[model samples]
Target chain A: MIQDRLRTRMGWLHAWSGFVFGLLLVCIFASGTIAVFDTELTRWLQPEVPPSATALTDEALEETLPTIRKLLERDEKPFITLPSERDPILRVQYHDGHEFLNIPFDPGTGQELAARATVGGTFFYDLHYSLRNGDTGIIFVTFSGLMLLIVLGSGIIIHLKELIPDLLVLRPFSARLRAWLDVHVLASVPFLPFAFMMAYTGTFLHTRSILPPVSYLASINAAITPVAVRAESPALQKEKTVVPALPPLSPLLHDAEKVVRAGQVGFILFLPKNILISRTDASGPARTREHVDFSYDGHFIRHVLLTTPLTRTQQVMEGIHYVRWGGAGMRWLYFISGLATTIMIGSGLVLFLMKRRRLSGGRVIFRLAEGLTVSVLVGFPLACSGFFWGNRLLSGGSEQRTQEEVTVFFLIWAASAVWGMGGCLMKWRVQVWRSELGLLAVLSALLGPLDLLTRSGGTVFHTPTVFAAVDLIALCVAAVAFQIARRLA
Target chain B: MIVLCSVLWIVSLSVQAVSEPRMLRIARREAVAPALTVRLMRWVSLVGLLLCLYQRPSTALFVWLGSFSIATVVVALGWAWRYRGVQRVRRTGGGS
Candidate 1:
């Protein structure tokens, strides 16, 4: 009787917790899953952006400094980041309230090109991290993550009976509870390490929010600052009154390489008064900290080494998060793990509503769950498809390109929500799922060919790396859609 | 020894699943049984030791140590609660 009571309590906790936060958790996971390959997606979407070759020794700051200085003379604090392997544009960013005025420069000629916004990549990034709602979103996500930790704990406790026995078992034809438990175990067990790390790191990420009162008491300035200040140093006054002619970038680059002992210099930043060269070692995988920042005024090296521990820690954290130090194999591992996390969260939500429907015999609750399932599972993909569609449809030189993209996203989402509600009214959960998946497959398959035909620069067949990846992912989506359609039928 | 451990595990699970009020008292007692606690502690320690051995003197060692420390704290809490419960029962002369 006591054991039965304990089981009841556990079941109650699981059901309530899952029902309340499942939908939001699914959104978070799906967005994050897509954002894992955000960079690749950006490249595939935008074909007009020109790729940069390695900056020649001859085309150093001596050649480029004048152009940069001339461009930045009017701005208060101008900065340039030299093109690296991932991004090949010499990006010049001028801070404007919460937004950046980005000017892409030709690495070879040092000529300023037309500015392009980073809305596509930035949107997905922000959605994953902040959910585009700022502090409220952060709080919601953090709370959901905490709840997830509890859910996992309770799940472990509840399934202690069959945990070991059911490790590899997937009873596809079992009752709803049994099937849900099987999926929960299957998804959770394989990526247990990832789940634990995500929880720990996620808590750490939201530490400021969790312990805000304490954090505020500890450091008031840190709590307020938009940009974190790493180091405190005496500002270098302009010693040379005259606008001194800058030294050639080749020598500076050579000197930086010697100091850092790196194979090749990635980027050379020409400040109005100083030149910064970012150099990384060839032996190790790409690390942010490995890229040494050197501030030089022509011949003199003002700052040789990083003076801030905070900056170093931040670099290491970025390195861990970005997995830049990990090669293709490690990246693939992270990708697979992220995919599993998405599946785990998505399936968990589905299971929650499924279980709830069994308990609550009301049509209202069932309809709500069905609508939410459709919105989250179908709406997210449709919104992403619309983002691509917006990119293609919007004129290249149009001022409202960003606005158009956002509009497309909202419109698709709203339409999906309506469609989901309508489907729920008709009790067409399986039919809606099948239909939406089919739509996704058709849209995904068309994306590559559309890009090839519409874009001037390159064809999908020619650039096998970018184009083939898109095609393959699309094909996978199509296959999944076909399977779902079949299952539904 | 393996048979004994498996029997203890099964007993703990059976205790956990009982729903009658009298059975619950027995179950709670079994849940915090010295034999069960010792077995759990040993398994946890073994896992920790193996991890520390595998990734000796590294971050993994620290992780094992941390988990062990947490388990120790949890066991202490469980013991304290059990002791309090027993004292309460003694005072009330097994009323509930």
Candidate 2:
């Protein structure tokens, strides 16, 4: 009886929490899965980039010096990123008061490519954590993550005993409820570690931004002033004088590479006072916070390291969560795992609604909830495809093109949401599911051929095969959607 | 070599499952004498996993995790197809 009581209590907590926050969690996990391959997706989004035969060598860096100098003269804080194996273009970027101006160059000859302005993979990355809402989004996401942790804990407690015996038991031919329950358990168990780590580290990454510990402590301490109120660092106080005839960047980059012998230089930041070159390779879980610092005259200053062990450990955990060190294999794994998480959560949501639909008959609130489930599950993917379609079809010369692309995504999503709610109100739930899923399948299948037809064959074909890979994946997704739509009762 | 180890691991898991009373009694089969093969296979599986870890920890972990995920789906589908067809439940004595 006590065991039954405990199970019942935990079940209530798990079901309610999963139901309430499942959609948001799905969005977060889905975006995060895509964000794992953000750079590759960026490349895929912009197919106009010409192929680069040159590598990120000293000679190539030297070739790009004149343009880098020109950019530096124009912008107060211009930075250059050297191409690595994953990203094969040299990027010179600066903030132009409103947003960023990114100029992609051929790594070999340093010739600029006239790539269209598009919000590449960074959109997904920003969407993952912030939902593009800035600080409010981070706070909301962090709260959702915390809830996820709680839900996971309660779920484990509810099934702790059965977990081992039913570890791999998935009885798909059983009753509907039983089959869904089995699938939920099966999906949750294997990816439990990954889900837990991502939630924990993701929360940690946002903790300082929202509820900074130092400031929180200071608020309680009457005698102590907050760190935010502290005097400006000497680094920020450096005078900005016109740097005429600056030293060459290639030798400085060479020196920086020599200092950090293990990793490749990813970014070169030019400040009025100093230069910072950070490691670009995130091929491992544990990454050192090491970067080469240089004086304004290109003199080697110091190699910065994490001073505290605690801070180092935190950074390593953050690195593992962010996954900047991995190559293609690791990234694919992260992506797949993230997709699995979305599936797990999505299946759980479906199961909850299925189990409760009968009991919620004739209830408006339940119908609304059902509509929401359909909108989030089928609608988001629909909107995403719309975004990609806009990227291909929208004129690049238009002002605020990125914002327009984002607007297209939300418009489709909102329309889908309205359709779903309308259908549910009119008792067309099954039709809504079938039609939306069919639309998704068609959109996904067409995405590949659409890009192929629109892109400059000569340039895109010669470039990295990531374009083809994305298209192939879209086709696969289309196939999955068709299967699901066909199988749905 | 990694593929070999993964196969060994799966085989070992199957062997270990057969030793369970629920599984064996459902099959109406007696336990293997001394359970020697099961023990041996278990050790081999462990050793194989360890070898994977020693070589590439991250890859091994992901592969192992993915293996489990695939195994769950495959086993579930296989069981449903083989035994649950034309019936609501399998003959495992556990009602869903």
Task: Indicate which candidate wins on TM-score.
Answer: 2
Best by lDDT: 2
**lDDT by residue for model 1 (A1-489), tens:** 887788788877866786567677777766666666665565555566664455633453344565556545554344555565556656555543222335566767766555435355546756776677655567678778788787777776777786544444443334446655666666666466666555555655665664576554444444344432322323533343333455566666677777666545655555555666665422232244333344444564554545378655544444444554444434444565666666677677777767666676258767877787788877887788767767776776777666677778888888888888788867777778777777877877676677677666666547646556666766676676666567663
**How well is each residue in A1-489 modelled by candidate 2, as lDDT tens digits?**
998899899999999999899989999998898889777777777788854457755556666657667776664677887777777888776654323446688777767778887777777778888887655577779889988898888889998987766665656666678878877887787678778989998987777655665665553342243333443556445354576555677878778878776446778887766788877646456566478988877788999867588777787777778888756765665776788788888888999889888889468888888899989988988898888898899997887887887889889999999999899988898899999899999999999879878788634445347887788788888898898889788
For every candidate in turn, the CA RMSD to the true structure comes to 12.9, 5.1
In Å, residue A151's CA in model 1 sits off its true spot by 2.5
Candidate 2 chain A lowest-lDDT run of ten = A219-228
Clashing pairs in 2: A282-A324, A282-A325, A282-A326, A283-A325, A283-A326
Q: How well is candidate 2 docked (DockQ)?
A: 0.33
Name the regions of candidate 1 deviating beyond 4 angstroms: A1-8, A50-106, A109-118, A171-181, A213-259, A263-318, A359-361, A425-431, A457-461, B1-96
Q: What shift in Å separates residue A107 of candidate 2 from its native position after superposition?
A: 1.0
